[model samples]
Target: MEFQLDKINPTKAIDLYRGMLKPRVIENKMLTLLRQGKISKWFSGIGQEAIAAGVMQNLNNDEYVLPMHRNLGVFTSREIPLYRLFEQWQGKANGFTKGRDRSFHFGTQEYHVVGMISHLGPQLGVADGIALAHKLRNEKKLTAVFTGEGGTSEGDFHEALNVASVWQLPVLFCVENNGYGLSTPTNEQYNCENIADRGVGYGMESHIIDGNNVVEVFTKMKEITESVRENPRPILIEFKTFRRRGHEEASGTKYVPEDLMAYWEKRDPIENYEKALMDADLLTKDDQKKFTDEFNEEIKTHLKKANNAPPIESSIEKELADVYQNFEPKNLPASTETNHIRFVDAISEALKMAMQKNHNLVIMGQDVADYGGVFKITEGFVDEFGKERVRNTPICESAIVSAAMGLSINKMKAVVEMQFGDFVSSGFNPIVNYLAKIHYRWNQNADVVVRMPCGAGVGAGPFHSQTNEAWFTKTPGLKVVYPAFADDAKGLLISAIEDPNPVMFFEHKALYRSQRSDVPTNYYTTELGKANLLKEGSQISLITFGAGVHWALDVLENNPDLSVDLIDLRSLSPLDTEAILSSVRKTGKALILQEDTSFGGVASDISALISKHCFESLDGPVETVTSLPTPVPFAGQLEDQFLAKSRLEKALIDLANY
Candidate 1:
């Protein structure tokens, strides 16, 4: 490499040296703070500076870089102010997250850098989505993301790589193989010789590079990045390195062998580069002393400023602010003129209208582009819009949703479809943990609408048929919508697209083509966090959503003697307590119905709220009608029996008699 340095100028050598050294200085400062108990934790990138420094110097400014926890060097090389990094550690309001995120878990869109989430694998898909956006806009830029060698073992890792490979997305997947996944050694983690070997399985080009050599890392990374930007394709790079420190400040390097530690210390990227620069006469003793003196003074200034800055403000009140999209309630135009349309067609209209209104809105799901989705709800969408906008993705549920999150964090909106709502479990982490918490944690709205074809009774089996409203409702910062009417479906979806938040929309599979209504042809928005009064009665209030709304209405409509009010809760998360309590007060009885399993389901929350708020008005105990607690059986008979339709009828009869 020194023989190769004749062509490299002294300035380039110094740049590489500075890049590798800055992060080490920052790491030492932060670790010193940790020792003084000023900071709670420290995840040092002592042995891994060269990888990020090399990549950051070569990447285009507009391209995105999704760095993991150990990639502090990447952030520093991107020219993020040193004091801001200190401010983040000090938990100041001026930090990137405005005091919301308390640790080194925030990023700046202006710099095209995304900070790490605890689960590192999901960010790969997020980076892929940003690259996809560049491709769509014909921007000559790519996104680079890094994860640990251990992260490739997660399901999301494979899903993200596969999606990027299939789409030929311009994403660089760098695996910093530091020999251990926490305390677990690489030998125990995988049977493969190297993590890059798995790249071929995903149809991605693979390379293994010496991560400890700053020059080698820079030369290879720059070449690969240029190629990827020109001809969009995901590439996998395995950086062979060693962690010089423990996993965090709390965990010392007791697990590391003495000999292994000695070997890594000798090959330290900064030390090696400094010696090399001196040998080439590109750096001198005085130059090194100058940097050390300046860095020491700089650290003191930043440390004092950060410590004096106000600590991050945290409260229950701030958590709820900006959790939902800000919008003024606009009612639908009242007119007798309406077009009779299927529920599926109504959804299609909503998607079409949303996409037409905003060119940035893109849809992704399995079989959606050519096959119009499994249920044919998205039929003719590809013909109307190009395949770029209406994409048919692989069976990578996690990437599908996670990528939408990435797109949403940018200026774009994404409408992601889960072929069946039950399959959302495969992608649940990103939706529940990352997507839902974005706005609440950092005020970053992932403007994504996940379309879930939900519910059972059609005997699609346990894996395909499920009503998961309860799972999402329990999670704060997510908007759960399950509309009963085609008109409400169109309106709610439009509002969801416009709103700057993550929304989990449940479209009942049973009603896609079976249900029909005169949906409004004109543009409109149904207010979220509100309920539609389907029927008016003084005897009992039937509160339900999704398929159960129709089921409850049928039970009461046939029995004209029993007057019942049907309140269709369109929004599940922001529970329509105003409509619910008002109906219960007037009717004097409350009946909660849902297609989800009875135990710990959406109805349970509503029932508890009703009991607590309208207990005095109740004639008998609050009644809840729901399916039995079991996997939705494949056999039609068993599924029907498992669903408590007959039990609901009996419950209604007993309530009426009571």
Candidate 2:
């Protein structure tokens, strides 16, 4: 598996350059169309066409590839239709994304091109997950991820590389280092002379190549890519080139220094490669003219076909149809068959069970495997499932989440663990933009669950302790679930895993080892978009969720005269409007309490919904109580005051009076 650069045929190099030039012509024509207001925006992969096309040429059509926005050159090399590229640019129905995504956002599962994600480095992690799944299933394939030098600045890029390195994943990270991230040069991004040096710190094989040298790129990358597929490992390929176009259609060249622009313009990949082919005697002036003429005609034909295609129907039906494909109720063993266990243990057991059922299930993230998770929830499962299935990922949060999104889209269930809920924010882009929105947008399901340990009061610092339920609850097409008791935890988790849409499963660290409850002794299941009435009373309805439910229960038990109806909002997104209205009708009063901040919180949403639907039934104003608008204090006295918990009996009496 040794690479011989000198052995590359001159004729093949000429052919490769010819292939690269077509995309550049397409980019130039599209830029003209963009200026005419025929296209909304365009991110040209102009000067780096050689690297994009060369690396892509080595990729098999059956293998997966995740591209960034400026990857039309690479995508064209992989046989993506030129007309569809124009249709995408025009935001037409026949576009690559079915008119749902912008020109830069596209996908084709049939060709194993996972997606063209607009969000920076997040897609790299997804590429890693897809590769890991292929390795586990013994599905002989490779995943190639192409990104920009600017993407390396994102935390996700580090996360993805670390996971791929630790797991020996079959993924090739191709960084198209085109001198500048828009107008900012590489010198401003890092102190290192080359972007490839970062790979050394991640324990990955690294290579630096002349991006404009199509021959060298094709020859050098072929063996490295082959080696990765043969024995699943990761490699980082840094292609040093320069961009000849502005960042996007609206951005002008004013910010770019005249000298730098002139220097890169002279070294443009399209023109330089054309000259190289003529020098090598593989192509004559007549041959170049004939090829160029044929390519322009090809582009015109595709554009005509793409523009004539009918638009994709944008409706609510589109959202309903792809939530789950072939969704049948899964056969589960009766609850009586399994022994009684703690909530955290049940969650671990569910992971084990799901992995055994579906070979596509992959568990990854920081300390999830041999360490059994920071809370010891996944104990001993790594030994049973092996390191491949139960993987211990690096401390890269963005990569872990993005990789999970990629795996999910490719029909693998990626159950990733975030060491803490606070770190989940690091992977927010992929979670919200790709994983969550993809289902509703292009009728694609990113079936992934990001397991986060949340809540507070267990002595974790302000950094470690925080709840982000509201953050995800507002996002469309995403499911958010929290468990109260041991049985609910297991049932909810199983349901979350079975769900077609992406879900954020929030597990309270405080509840993991606090106290055990009596779970069901027989078969039981939890439904998505439903709530539970923990207690039934008539005085007032107390709407709460997560750790706040426990706080509500304690107050009700202490006060006999309160007669409060308490509801546990298990699923936050598709709120149980019927149950909410029914309880509010009987009680004629309500109160929404939570441990998170009162401003722009879940409580506010509940109040808004209630005000619209149950305003006529209200005896007085709906009381909403929540934590103070500040960070969770470390001091016990300060925490108690900041927390939304009311003093034992008196608060319940006060609520009943209202």
| Clash statistics: count for each candidate | 0, 3
Per-residue lDDT of candidate 1, residues 1-658 (tens digit): 2324554677877888888777888788888878988788888889889898888888977778888888888877788777788777666766777766656587677787887789878888898788888888888788888899889888889999999999898889989999888899988889999899998798899999889988888888878988887888999999999988888868878888999999988888888888888887888999998887777788788778877887676777665665654556556553466899989888998898888888999999999998999888788988888899999998888988889988876678899999999889988999988888777566677889999998887878988888888899999889999998898898899888888788999999989888898998877788788898988988888888888888886777777788888899999978889999999999888888888888999888889999999888989879999898998888988888877565787887788778
| Candidate 1 least-lDDT 10 residues | 1-10
Tell me the tens digit of each residue's lDDT in model 2 across 1-658: 1223345686666668777878877877888888888767787777877787788878888888888877776677777777776777666766655566686676777667766566677788888878877877787688899888998887778878888888788889999898778878788987897889988898988999888777778878888887777777899989888777788857767877889889888877767767766666767889888888888899889888977877656667764655434355565544555555777776776677677776778888788888898988788887888887787776777777777777776678878899999998877888887787776455667778889898778778687878889999888778899877777777777777877778899888888877466665444457766889999998898888878888888877767677778999888876787888899999998888878887999889889889999889998788888888899888888878778884424555676775
Query: Each prediction's TM-score against the native?
Result: 0.97, 0.92
At residue 92, candidate 1 shows an lDDT of 79
TM-score of 1: 0.97
Best candidate according to lDDT: 1
Residue 498 alpha-carbon offset, candidate 2, angstroms: 1.4
Q: Candidate 2: give the clashing pairs.
A: 125-403, 126-402, 126-403
- Worst-scoring 10-residue span by lDDT in model 2: 1-10
